[model samples]
Target: MNEELAELAASGATALVSAMGTDLWQEAKGLMIRVLGRARGSRHNELTVALDRASTAARGAVDARAVDYWTEALSRLLDRDPDLAQDVMALASLRIPERPGNVVQLISATDSAEAFAVQYGSQHFASGPKSRERGERP
Candidate 1:
């Protein structure tokens, strides 16, 4: 499989798993069903139920392996149904919950000096533990 397609699969799976039990659950579930249905053809209903089960598992807490499972599923689906892959990509792009431009979170920590920094897409983030700061009692 192409690396890009693999990335899409991984991203879609993560989004699907994270959306479980959130306000976006229904939308995310529906999008997965639709995309996987296109790939599964006559097996659409079966895939739908499986996706639901996975979502239910994710509702309690999402583990990294869950993302891998769904990612592999999507990758195989795309491999077998190359034509449907475009649709999957498009749906994933639009409805997988958080696209590139979405602001998923904004975290801010203030101190006299910065210890760590993360910068992405015009956003800057920094953090430092109080325990590591100077002149602080343990």
Candidate 2:
């Protein structure tokens, strides 16, 4: 499997899972079904039932493995239709909403040295009630 394609599957799966029972659920499900193409027909009812169950489970308390289950399902679909990788990725990207306005970030390190540090996506950092000086360590 293509690494990038696999990554897209994983990401798209998470988005689909998160959007379950939301306004985006139908849209995501449609896109996912289309991506599945002919294979979808064979598993149409099965998939629908699974998605509904997932949505119901999500609506309740919490299911930590929901994302993983959805990711695996999406991955299997991708594996079945390697040709739809790009289209699936495009659909996945569409599910991700863009953030408007300026984004701010604050990063702090204390008594630690590291190489190749990287961060992605929206994040926030707020100082606690008690402020502490960051001292450098030799």
Leading candidate by TM-score: 1
> How big is the positional error of residue 66 in model 2, measured in Å on the Cα after superposition?
1.7
In model 1, state the lDDT of residue 6: 81
**lDDT (C-alpha, whole model) for all candidates:** 0.69, 0.64
Candidate 2 weakest lDDT stretch, 10 residues: 113-122
For candidate 1, write residues 4-51 as lDDT tens digits: 788888877877777777777777787787787567555567667778
TM-score of each: 0.58, 0.54
Evaluate model 2: give its lDDT: 0.64
Q: Look at candidate 2 and tell me the lDDT of residue 12.
A: 79
To one decimal, what is the Cα RMSD in angstroms of model 2 from the true structure? 10.7
- In terms of lDDT, the poorest run of 10 residues in model 1 is 94-103
